[model samples]
Target chain A: MLPLPVLEKAQTELVNYADSGMSVMELSHRSGLFTDIITGAEQLLRDLMNIPDNYKVLFVQGGASQQFAMVPLNLLSNSKKADYVNTGSWSKKAIKEAKKYGEVRVIASSEDKNFSYIPEVTSSMIDPEADYVHITTNNTIEGTAFQNIPDTGGVPLVADMSSNILSEEIDVSKFGLIYAGAQKNIGPAGLTVVIIREDLIGHAPESCPTMLDYKTHSESGSLYNTPPTYGIYMAKLVFEWLKELGGLKEMEKINRKKAELLYGFLGQSAMFQSPVQEDSRSIMNIPFVSPSAELDAAFVKEAKEAGLETLKGHRSVGGMRASIYNAMPVEGVEALVEFMKHFEEKHAQ
Target chain B: MLPLPVLEKAQTELVNYADSGMSVMELSHRSGLFTDIITGAEQLLRDLMNIPDNYKVLFVQGGASQQFAMVPLNLLSNSKKADYVNTGSWSKKAIKEAKKYGEVRVIASSEDKNFSYIPEVTSSMIDPEADYVHITTNNTIEGTAFQNIPDTGGVPLVADMSSNILSEEIDVSKFGLIYAGAQKNIGPAGLTVVIIREDLIGHAPESCPTMLDYKTHSESGSLYNTPPTYGIYMAKLVFEWLKELGGLKEMEKINRKKAELLYGFLGQSAMFQSPVQEDSRSIMNIPFVSPSAELDAAFVKEAKEAGLETLKGHRSVGGMRASIYNAMPVEGVEALVEFMKHFEEKHAQ
Candidate 1:
């Protein structure tokens, strides 16, 4: 969901951006105004995340899935191998994409348990010669998140935190790169936020497509080609919004409070069940199931009628998921809980 | 620039899109509402372009530059060569990208003339063994356009119509594929509109990155992953607007009128020089230069103050370019011509 104020701001500036007499969408990517938006986005992200001066923050397109291919194309060439922790479907897809370019070792997997929890990853599991150890920090489909980042020894840790990037603080220096598809906690899709260390920028192979080469984008400051201009403008606003609200730490507080209210109700409710383990449950994506498939369907339908939306779980999970991202208010979570209680009282089996 | 109607439509629907109670940006690409948006966009484009039922309209991201790599990665693998007609910077970039994947025969080039004209591309100029013949239909910077599509015999004619697509009528069935970056006449940046024949769909090499593979995206209906949701939605609106405005032929009429108004003035002006040959001049982007460099600078600055924006010529061209695409109204052109007349009267000496 869009932040209301941001949408209003964009609406007011839809036709004319800062007296340029054109929407941000209409500005050339090479224009001074557009360059400022992109660079300002990077700087805001850096300020909020405490990203080191050495890290190159790229505003890219094609989402995290493209990054799945780009990461291997750019980095996995040197080592010809990478360790992948299969905690969920997103990681599995990343592993599958990485295999097209290099050898991907499954160092750890919670797939055996239907990806209901995060896998226990250790340095022993990592290949020392591996270029990077990859992980999906948050699983939107499976409703799991790594509470803390894994120790990859000297190997770089690459995380696809598509659903959880701005919800909490992360040490940017710890990972070689962190990529997030900007639809969840960020502003929109089409914009992929990639924060990669300087050392990780320039090792792409000859076969690497220029667009896939991190160095090309990093060197050009993500202006190598026409980027998602309006999306980047929205992202800049979201970044500024985060900063205005006292950054990620403050966001984490609100997120935790929101998640706790819903999770607390789910834990105590007799009719509902939280499928994820306590430590692995995502504050951003909360998936729960009713006692029966029919009830789960009914609950999803009824919730939508009552104006709580996108509550149906992913087809793979087959239940319900309340993806309470940064934009989801505590009141929204409370409303969901109240609806769950109302349904439970009426349809107590 | 974004069309006023499209931007206003997007603004009205910015927070809640068509009673879905969510921004188009928030909708899952897999959801029915978004499926309708993408498919609706395709159908509208198909209708507007009179595209054959055999063609697949894929809404993609990373702009036309991504297509530069993707085209060769998918098409140039087996034949190992593609004939490239270099008209301008965009085509040169495409040639550079295709070289990474296969041999690119420079069948013809207008680079000797600083890309002021489109080279004569005859059927004999195309290598029979070539995978495809690549041409940039419109040169945005050089202000040149192909008045007629080149015949490629049995070979596929691949054209990059980034600056011209949807602004005028073209026979879609005459080419194997046409890809356009949407920032020009289509909608906004980040969305690429690819209209490819069904026969041209699935021949990517084994080494192709999944994101770069046309087959992956085509088979999945451009939702192989999260697409540029809002951009596609905006494109859909633009397409609908085009359709509502009597489609491309009608757009051509307006575009032609606008271009004529500006070019007609420039042609007769004693102080200004039209750098391009009249036959090769683009109705979409028209570049003109004044008597001196200082006057050109003054004109651009004064034009900006007069609300004529982005009129500065590409540095390579070193003049003024008034890109009068479909979205540029005739009044805008009239205003520009009046300003030019006023400026001329002041500095005619």
Candidate 2:
């Protein structure tokens, strides 16, 4: 979900952007107006995240799912071997895609516990000769996240931070590359944001598809071939909203409060419980289960009727999941908790 | 440019789509509302284009540039070779990308004439064993278009129709696949519309990225991953606008009238001349030139001051280009022609 103000601002400028007499979607990608949008977007993002000068920010399409393939296609040039942490479904998909290009070793995994927690990673677990180490910083389906960034010695660390990027402050120097789909904390669904160190830009093999090469995008400044113009405009508005809300540090405090409000209720409730471990819980997606499948179904149905939409869990996991991303107000969590309390009282036996 | 009516409708629904209390960008892809959106969009397109049952419409991402590699990666399984016709810049890029995956033969080319016209493609020029024959049906940079769809003798014709897909009526059965970037005649830049015959699906090798494979998207109904939900919704609005305005046949007539207004002026004007041959000219993009570069610069600047934007020609082929897409009204073309006449009179030799 986007910040309400961002959506409203976009609505105001939807038809005639910046008095250009054309919708953002209609502007030519090479036009000066669009160039300013993309350039301002990148600058705003860098300011919000405190990105380093050594990192190149690329706005591309195909989401994080495409990045699953691209991360390997562009980075497996050294040893052609990588270590991956299998935290949940997204990690497994990334690992599978990476295996197509090189040897992928699962250095650590939480699958033995139904992906309820993030597996610990240390420098010792990583292959020194490996091209890079991959991890999913937050698993949207499994409701787990790495509580701490792992150290990989000198190896480049690649992360898929699709669900939880910009939720809190982080050191830009912690990883060699970071990619996130814009659907979550960024803006919309079509655009993917990639931040990669300059050294990692040109490693793709010569046979790599030009579109899949990081160097191609980096060289062209992400304008290689019409890089999702409208989505970038939306993202710029979102970044403006973030800056107005006092950047990630302030956003993180509010997010933590929202997560605590819901999790505090779940901890005390008899009818509902969080499926994830305490320390590994994701601030973005919080999955919970009731006493029975029927109860779960009733909870999801009633939640929708109460104006809380998309409360259903992924089919792979049985119960209900609450995806309270950065855009979810604290009152939204309070409302869900209040609804749960009333339901618990009514369903008491 | 998108139709003004469509942009207005999108602005009205930008924040609370269908009273769902969420922007279309915020809606879950799996939600019933979004399902209706994607389904309605595909149906409307099918109705407007008269697409056959055997053709599957897949809304994927990464634009036509990604399709440059995907076409060969998926279709080169049989003969490890494909035939391409060089029309202009886009054709050259597509050929370069395809050559990375297989042997790409340029059987017909208008490059000898500076890509000012479409070359004739006969069945004899095609390698019968070629997996498919590729062509850029509309060249945006050079302002050329194939007046006739070349028959490939049952060898499956593929087209990159990015600049002119929805502007006219065409027989879908003649092409094995048709891919267009949505920014031109469709809704936005992020979404790519791929109309492929069923027989051409499932041909990608196992090593191909899941996101790049046609069968992956076709089988999942383009829901294998989160789509560009907002773009799809906008396209649905565009389709609705087209249907309300009588479909492609009516659109084609209006488009022809707009092209005539501008081209007829170019034909009669002594100061300005169209670079393209009359029969091979595109109704979508029209490139014209003045007697000198100084005059061209003056005309573009004067046109912009008169509220005509993006009329400057592409850098590779300089002068002036007025891209009158499906959304350009007859009045807009008339205004452009009127401005041209005034400029020509003031600069009379």
Candidate 3:
């Protein structure tokens, strides 16, 4: 979900952006007006994230799912082997895609426990000769997140941070590459933000599709064939909103408060419980299970009627999941907890 | 430019789409609301285009540039060779990308004439063993378009119709796959629409990235992952606006009138002239030039001051371009023509 202010700003500017008498969607990608918008967006993002000078921030399309293949295609030039941590469904998909390009070793995995936690990773687990180490920093479906960034010795680390990118502060130097879909903690879908170190920018094999090469985007500053113009504009507004709200550090406090309120209720409630482990819980997506499937269905239905939509869990994991991203106000969590309490009282036997 | 009505409707619904208390950007990809939006969009397009039942409409990302590679990757399974017509800059890029995947044979090209006209393509020019024959139906940069669809015998035809997909009526059955980036006559920059024959699907080799394979999107109905939700919604609105205006036939008439008004002025004006040959001129993008580069710059500046934006020609071609797409009303074209006449009079040599 986007910050409300960002959505409203987009609404106001949808038809005539900045008196140009054209929607952001209608502006030519090479026009000076759009140039300002894109450059301004990059500056805002760099300021918000405190991105390092060595990192090239690229705004491209196809989401993190596309990055699953791109990360391997562009980075697997050295050993053609990568170490991957299989935390959940997304990580498995990433690993499967990576296997197409090179040898993908599952250095660590939480699959044995239904992917309920982030697998521990150490320098010893990684292959020193590997091209890079891959991990999903947050699993939206499994409701698990890496509590700490793993050290991969001198090996470059690549992360799919789609679900929890801007929810917290992080050191930009921690990873060699970071990619995230703009749907969560950024803006809308269709735009993918890739923050890659300069050294990792041009390693793709010649056969790599020009659209998939980081060097193509880095050289063009992400203007390589109309880089999701409206999405970037929306992201710029989102970054502005985050900055106005005192940036990620302050946003993280509000997010943690919201997660704690919901998880605190779940910990005490007799009818509902979080499916994820305590230490591995994701502040972005919190999946919970009731006592029975019927109860879960009824709770999801009643919650929708109570104005809380999309509370249903993924089909693979039964029960409900609450994705309280950065945009979810603390009151939203409070409302969900209140509904849960009332339902527990009504269903008591 | 998008239809003004469509942009207005999007602005009105940007924050609370259909009273769902969430922006279309915030909707879950798996939600019923988004499913309706996407399905409704496809149906509207089918109804408007009269697309055959055998053709699947896939709303994918990465634009036409991405499809340059995907076309060969997915279709080159049979002969590992394809035919291409180099009409302009875009076609050259397409050929270059396709060369990475297979043997790309350029059977026809207008490059000998500086891509100022579309070259004729006959069935005899096509290699029957080719997996697919590629063409750019309308060249945006060079102001050229095929007046007639080429007969490629049994070889499948793939088109990059990014600049002119919705501007006029066409026979969808003639092409094996038609892909267009949405920024032109559709809605925005992020979403790409691919209409492919069922026989052409699932041909990508296993090494192809899951996101790049047509089978993945075709099988999942373009919901394999989070799509550009808001862009799809905007495109749906555009389709509805087109349907309201009597579909493609009416849109074609209005577009023709706009193009005629601009081109007619250029024909009569002594100072300005269209570079494209008349028979191969595009109704979508019409590039024109004044007597000198100084006059061209002056005209572009004056046009901008007169509230005409993005009239400057592409860098590869100097002077001016007046793109009169489906969304450009006749009044806009009339205004451009009026400004052109005034500039010509003032700068008479």
Rank candidates, lDDT, best first.
2, 3, 1
- Please write out the lDDT profile of model 1 over residues A205-232, one tens digit for every residue: 8778889899888888888988888888
Q: Is candidate 1 or candidate 2 better by lDDT?
A: 2
User: What DockQ does each candidate score versus the true complex, computed on alpha carbons?
Assistant: 0.80, 0.87, 0.89
Candidate 3, superposed: residue stretches over 4 Å from native: none
Q: In candidate 3, what are the lDDT values of residues A1-349, reduced to their tens digit?
A: 8888888888899899898788999887888888998999999989988999999999999998899999999999989999999998899899999999999899999999999988789889889999999989999999999989999889999999999998999887999999999998898899999999999988899899999999999999898898899999989999889999999999999999999999999999998999898999999999999989999999999998899888999999879999999988998899999999999999999
Model 3 scores a C-alpha lDDT of 0.92
CA-lDDT, candidates in order: 0.88, 0.93, 0.92
Clashing pairs in 2: none
Model 1 segments beyond 4 Å from truth?
none
Q: In model 1, state the lDDT of residue A158.
A: 96
What's each prediction's TM-score? 0.98, 0.99, 0.99
User: What are the chain B TM-scores of all models?
Assistant: 0.98, 0.99, 0.99
Q: Candidate 1: deviation at residue B211, Å? A: 1.0
For model 2, residues A53-145, the per-residue Cα lDDT tens digits are 999999998989899999999999889999999999999999988999999999999999999998889899899999999999999999999
Per-residue C-alpha lDDT of model 2 across residues B129-227, encoded as one tens digit per residue: 999999999999899999999989979899999999999999999999999999989999999999999999998998899899999999999999999
